[model samples]
Target: MPLSSRLPILLACVVALGGCAGHPKGVMSPVAVSNKTGGSKVDMLVVTSRVPSDDPATLFTGERSPHPYLTDISVSIPSDSKRKAGTVQWPKKLPPNPDTDFAVTRVQQLKSVDQGRTWFRAHVVGGHALVFVHGFNNRYEDSVFRFAQIIHDSGAKVTPILFTWPSRASLFDYNYDKESTNYSRVAFEQTLRTLANDPNVKDITVMAHSMGTWLAMESLRQMAIRDGRVAPKIDNVILASPDIDVDVFARQWTEMGEKRPKFTIFVSQDDRALAASRFISGDVQRLGAINPADEPYRSKLEQAGITVIDLTKVKGGDSLNHGKFAESPQIVQLIGQRLVTGQTLTDSNVSLGQGVTAVIAGGV
Candidate 1:
């Protein structure tokens, strides 16, 4: 089924599984799980919330406390090699607080650890650590699991860490979602700083999607300004389907200066959601939705030593524009593989061919 049509059904399934059990008022709702396999079980966390839909600015101005909704979750993955179904259940609601904590209820050891087709304890043995920032309307578990799948499928050896900010998860509250993105910036930076201080983590790569890109850039900017240098621990930054204003992003990039990472951006001219973003921001020129065929922003980003991947022609899902990274297996593989190896893709890896392409002329 088309992803657009499939979204409602998937959401209904998530709700019907009773994952919202014991949800606190004015906080995030819980996720429901339906396990087809009655095998070993483990606990996870879920959060849900509600907000006004029409305006994007409302998200930031709301008086809502910045407290994360916590829950105890149980997940059951099939034990049989042939079975591939499982369910996740959220059992209790947690109090609102600035500090969040998780106590693993139970864990089931996987029989085999092939790609992310199965679940296992996430451990970073030797590779770099990757921190993923999800776009608007994403729950903690959804982001983590999706990224885990990508990381595993790409055969990346790095530990995957999800930096989940609070999301209302309602289509109606576009403004509220934007506000939450802004509110989470400080917290996101704290997490990065903490990770940078860790001895076990050798290098870090940040993958921020949609509005999450704003948070990532802001956090990085803060880190750089504070230390007077880009945190050497961080290696790369990936922005996929960023929803920021092109002018705003340009200013941000300019401020970043030499502190920037080996940056990569995935843009598509066909992204419809970005069209809406352009209307909302009233900007005729935008970077996130640039047409690779025209290569308008490619030159600028390349000059900044940022790699641009134009996936406008890559075909796969109905939500093609919205979920190119997660839905497209090839894109996922490329990101996972490169991130795992800590390889910085340059013009050579992209094969610009003969004359100077916009990406090459721009500087990348």
Candidate 2:
């Protein structure tokens, strides 16, 4: 109601994002990889703009870095055949077991862009790649572990590239996190440009979650403005639980011009994290919290040929209902098989045929 009333509620939502400090720091420290290890592994090329941490274990901090930092990290997943999909099983103890925990199996620092290009040549099969952007309140290791889980569970057959930005990982630093995205826009744009320019990269899927969507959209908008269009290689843009202001997103979409990438958004009205974001931004509706089936959104989104999947009734492991995209097995795999892997999809009644039947609105 009043500003005083809203502040406490916003702070409470911020508190739901706690527990980052509870985990051990520097979980990125590489562990010995053994041929005898039973669990699976996911290796990612991480490009970050966060200042390198003084502690080697942590690798990067929330503060900004002058240059883009690159690393290749391998993560070991739990061996259980019945392991829950869309969840990162963080190690309860250090030097985690490959059979029972998510652990770092290998870590390497790429010396230069040439070295990264070499990676692209070696890894990108048939020119398919996935670029992931982590959201606010995430540390370096948090994004790593989560992206690893996604790649593992989604089973997307593509070169995995993670673009992690500087985030204090403190919910109280929400405004600072938002600004960090703005500051790192150029670096992120550079990342997209590099991938687009690579001959080995024929197709790219850019996926952004939470406030990272703001950064991703801005980068795309800038790219479209600079290059006369969003890169043709960047075919699909997935925004999940995006924390973008609706009006701002409309401007971004307009700036991207007519020949833009196909957009798919995952939204839920029950997203408490976005509710806090709404209050902090003067109650403007966030794009990820809209109902695509109703009102001005329905006609506008349909006219733009944008797809929106509403996950309001989709039960998620997240208490806040803010992470259904990453927390639900059906939805994540649907992303991998159909959208990220470059499948030809159409809007139909059986939207994303992964046993997830709650396709309330538009789809691709």
The TM-score, computed over Cα atoms with residue i paired to residue i, of candidate 2 is: 0.94
Cα lDDT tens digits, model 2, 132-192, are 9999889999999999888888889889999999999887788899999999999999999
Q: TM-score of every model?
A: 0.67, 0.94
lDDT, residue 183, model 2: 93
Over 170-243, each residue of candidate 1 has an lDDT whose tens digit, in order, gives: 54456777887777776677667766776666888888898788888888887778788668888888888888
- Write down the lDDT that model 1 would get: 0.56
Task: Go through the candidates in order and give each one's C-alpha lDDT.
Answer: 0.56, 0.85
Best by TM-score: 2
- Model 2: which residue pairs collide? none
